[model samples]
Target: MHEAEEAESLLDAGLRALFAADLPVGLALLDRELRYVVLNPALAAFNGVSSEQARGRSVAEVLPEAFPTLEPRLRAVLDEGAELRNFQVQIEVPSRPGELSEWEASYLPVRGADGAVLGVLVQAVNVTAQRRADHAMRRSEAHLRQVLDSLFAFVGVLDADGVLVEANRAPLEAAGIRAEDVLGKPFWDTYWWSHDAELQAWLREAVQRARGGESVRRDLLVRMKDDSRMTIDFMLAPLRNEAGEVVQLVPSAIDVSDRVSSEARFRSVFETAPDGLALVDPQGRLSLVNRSLARLFGYTEAELLGRPVADLVGEGDRARHEGLMRSFLRAPEARAMAGKRHVVGRRGDGSPVQIEVALNPVPSAEDPLVLITVSDIGERLRAQAQIQAALHEKTVLLQEVHHRVKNNLQIIASLLSLQSRHADAGTQAALRDSQRRVMAMALTHQLLYELNDFSALELGPYLRRLTQLLHDTFARQGQSVELRIDAPEQGLRIDLQQAVPCALMVNELLTNCFKHAFPDGRGGRVHLRAACTPQRRVQLELQDNGVGLPPGVRPGQGGSLGFQLLPLLADQLEAEFTLFEGPGTRIAFEFPLPPVEESGHA
Candidate 1:
């Protein structure tokens, strides 16, 4: 009963009292034989037994489900005097089927007065709920990573100091950078935008503004690893805690490079159009005009911009033009006017010139706008007037020439007729042929004088009239001689160079058919055809039932002047001529048609 023994006894009683108290944690003491010598009420409850039933029994009998794991730890503490701290254990019992309870247990060797190992003291805590919560937190973190990485927009999480903590996949991929190059670094110092020091300073200001409880949004040009820049709609939003203080800054951005480039291109086209283009606002004022418009009106662009559109119209038409402009602004659509319908544009020098205009309305946000395209037609009108005057003068000259020539030829034919009356029979026949040839030339000049289109002759009408004249000239020989012409619905036209040769050939063919085909007062029909093929070739076919062309007298081999002239005319036209022998004579020729004249249009 010395002082030290008394202190020991006091300490032991206090330890026993503390262990017996009602607590959530279980406490137990085991003997050197790995048997439970003492256990509190909580330990007994955890083992599904009473405290009295747990004392002086082996650990196996008290807690059969926990004994296998506890025996080794107890043996170490008893034999080697070692201490086990916080060893995790899974507890199961029959009452809670298919459920495992987790516990953290600590085994410490208890010492006696002589420092000898006596038994092991065990302390355990039920950690099943805490372990489940930790596992759920890990799953939620992985799910959040999945959601953030799936977005195409650049998204990042930053601390209030503008230090990047987490970033999604897009920013890293766009800049061709690795996550290690951005994460945990200051946002402005990242490879996506670190090249520009001024931009970085501006970004820092935006971060400060976000930290001060305000959102910051801006258009930023961020450079990539390859030195390519991109326009981005960048935003930084503050995330506040329950106390309404900003704890984090969330930065997000979307690439707007294409939109920016498109706007630039559209602006360039508006300013550089070739025509005199102007944009008029709903108030009838010119909002914009290109360089062409300024030059056309003899005014600087600054002088025209913001000016009323009525200023460009003639003084007499200003009121009417302004009224129409206002009316169009109400509900505008596309409008066009032909250049033939002339309008006057008052230049800056106060002179008027012919102009053509088209107005088209563009869709707008608030006020309506019209696009005006102006074209000056002054030179075109002047050129047309000059052409008309020159053509009239040429017409008069041609008519005078034709009139004199026709009169002279008629006089020659008259002379021939008078001389034939006095000459011998053979000489009279020669004089008569000369008269007929001169008469044909006179007829061509008469047709040209009447039509007056010197460039081309209407072949259908001209041929029909010529044949009629020829038939009448030979009517004294026989009244039963017939003439027929086949042509297209629209009469064919040929240039004068082509028409002259064609007329001569036609006259010879018809004359021969009439003079020899039906002799002795006999009569027959003669056919003439003219056609233009789709491939731009002209074809003429003439035939007659004229005694089968007087056997052995082919087209080019005939001894008569008319027969000899046929091949010469065909060669002049670069044509292919064929004569077929039959009950009726068939003659056909084809030549390429001349191209239509396009110059000197009036």
Candidate 2:
């Protein structure tokens, strides 16, 4: 073979091998006709034609519609007379799966020999997968674009160089930027701000990580087109080539202004909580201890972190503390974790202090965790001591006052008793009634001085004491009565004002029961019960198994001083008064329990 024939033969062989490879190759050969002297199987198979059909065809013969830019590209190659590799082009071919014709092509150029013109070579790689992928990617890009358009958020994409290559309509419109003005510009160049360094630094880190094959997402403050910057949360990724080298960055952005403000508010509340707060791990160690908690144990957070919670509890309290932690892990929603409870915490010196603890289990404290609030009750204890001192002084003063009042009342009773001896029957009866009233009031003061719960008097105990006093006073005068006082175990506290009136009313009732009902001098049983009903009304009933009320006058109804006092006392108590003489004489006084003067019972 001559050198030229030999070269053509070698060139044809090389072209065959290049197209036979799966990597997609195309070739075009020309003399003066711009025809294909040789075409590979890849180009032929992709075109759905035989090599015979392609060999003699011009660029316009095989694809009439592909000649627009293609003709120009071919002419350029003809004019330039040089080889080109991997230049991108778009062209349409017959469709598969009954869709429109799919697009395909290559970067076209001329294949040449030394010092001579050859034909234009088209390396038509079947870039269908990449093309479809790009189409799908564009559809995805359109979807994101739609979302970004409607939201109030500022969204944008950045290249790896901190340049704002593209922005959504929202941010662009908000910044008053013309669509064409800011494209392909650095983000910081559009606006100047103090936080530019922060944005740039973090974004650079994200780019570096993206380049290294890791995904990066962060929140940052970015400058806007209006020279104002707002906080935003952004996501970025490095777009890799087929060789996996990062050539560009694709990013998504969202505004997080509200989230940042909300987080700041929540943080303020968490840090300034009045109670000692801590995050105790399920393993019994403390993961986080707040400032108040550190102060509670006289240690800094560094000293308490990772330390077992037992170190801050007394030996007796350690087991209890462990049990609580276990309970938190098991149910977390128990009331014990929600309500306050007395506890003991150990100081740095290993001494214990009283505390009231309220615990709440969160899904996460550092995102998820259990929260404990320990209130130091040491000051409360001291206050209680102070209260005890005051109570002691008040008791002494009250006792002295009671003694003097009792003496004065007794003196009046004694004078009445002494005067009743020298008077006529009507006068003597009046004096004796007045004496009973004095004695009733005197006895109440004495009871007040004796009991610690001085705010209210227990009705049962008061009745029993009064019945005994009445029985003792009248026993010698043929007025013998057996008094039975039946009542519940609970006591009621009545203030001194209520106590005096109630006592006087009781005294008169008992005196009348003794004086009139049992004229036959028979023994009797009195049931004195105090009950608080579901409607929050309090009742005191005085019933007897002795004789009923005398004749036409009922117990609380008419003519007598004893009956008259009932209505006055009822009015004083804001009570409904009822007196009936059914079996014996049962008198019940019901009242809406007054707003507690000082809490009725401990």
Candidate 3:
């Protein structure tokens, strides 16, 4: 009936009522020595023991595995009368030996009538399922973040009010910015668009549109952290909830600066090129024409577009041009059309203008196109014609000069021959050699005029003719010396500068063989070969099957005039000359040929 006794009785009654409620919460009361004094059925089940068995048992005896961690906290509460709130722990019960569970517990100090601590009251709840769910949620969020960061594109999440909530690592790193720089700020106010007032305004409107459940996409020029500008293909799409309400905005962007720059450069080149260029569609109709092309045909760009390409040509060639265009469309290739014949284009005023046209195919699978370049060659053709006429006049004058010089040399040779008839024996021989030398010079001029190429002549035919002339003058009447000439049908060409010296050299060598090798009517053979070597040089070899040179008489060291001239001619040709002393004298020389020019004449 005392006041303190009455309060303790009421508290006992409330504890009994709660324990009998059979709730899932674990409740217990421990004595000062941390022994179980009383416990509900739930707490007894948590400890894997009955209430009768757990009562009067020590805390370590009941939960030995968890006692080490819980002993300090329990002592703190019991010794200091402290109230420990919401302390979490893990415990494995005797019934489920390896199965551990999580718990949230609170310990309150129980007081008696004199306000002294009597026992400790414990309240616990199982929170294992909740902790597991929270762990799973964190793992899922980390996985999503990793996936977003791996993307090469910029990605961001915005609240319904257009405030930036999340930005992927790609965009942050690309702009050299941290997430803190833009998170929780308005999307239009971020570094990407804030540099441009007009763009920011447009982006704000676009965000509003997305919030209204509309998707907006466009190419925008955005500024980076370094103050550099780049183009991005940006899009803002709405993310809606189950109730069909827009809850957030997802903004994504991909960098497209390089592609846009390339397109711009191509456009500039197409418009500013000097050649009259036109783009023709697969139908052979002009789709685009540059300013030069429009001016060349005396038509405006508007007038030229969609016009049949064949219409620009003369009427007589229109049908043929159309046919050729059709053939080219079937299998496209790059070629020049003006090389086969003169291409005459008709201007707007029906005047014929000479043109050179080239066609190049553009690679496109869906839409095939041809790039046509037309050059107005009217003035060029006139200039070329004038040059050709002048060149022809000079060629005729050169031929006439060569012919008159050849005739004058022959007259001199005849005079030498007539003088030799009345001179002494030695004088006659000297005059005959002099006459042969003059004749050799004339043969070169004759070949130049006959071949109509004053620049170069084929060495094979030149040597053949020169050798025949020497044989006729030096061979004795009774000697039967046979001559063999071996040379390619083509490719052994020497320029005029080398040809004259080459002719005189061959004349001297053959004349020496005829006069010295086959003396006293002795029959012999002379073989001459000319070929192109792999190292791009001409090789000439002359072998005679007769008495060789005298002992110790090397070529170019003999006392005769022919031997003296050999070294000079070889030097003029930049040739490597050598001789082999054997039964028959073998003389060989090689010299580099000039590089052939584009005209294919050399």
Best by lDDT: 3
In the range 93-143, model 1's lDDT, one tens digit per residue, is 432446777888899999997999998898976677546667999999989
Global lDDT scores for all candidate models:
0.82, 0.72, 0.87
Candidate 3 lowest-lDDT run of ten:
333-342
Could you tell me the TM-score of candidate 3? 0.63
Q: How many Å off is the CA of 450 in candidate 1?
A: 3.8
lDDT of 3 by residue, 347-450 (tens): 99999989878777777435768888888899988999999999999999999988998999999999999999999998998899889999999999998888
Give the candidate order by descending lDDT.
3, 1, 2
Sorted by TM-score (best first), the order is 3, 1, 2
**Candidate 3's error at 412, in angstroms?**
2.1
Better of 1 and 3 by lDDT: 3
Error of model 1, residue 184, in angstroms: 8.5
Clashing pairs in 3: none
Candidate 2, 264: how far from true, in Å? 9.4
Give candidate 1 misplaced runs (Cα > 4 Å).
1-176, 179-220, 226-228, 231-275, 295-300, 315-342, 348-350, 358-370, 375-384, 398-421, 424-429, 442-449, 489-491, 596-602
Candidate 3 residue spans exceeding 4 A from truth: 1-167, 173-218, 222-230, 234-252, 257-269, 324-342, 362-366, 474-476, 532-537, 552-559, 590-602
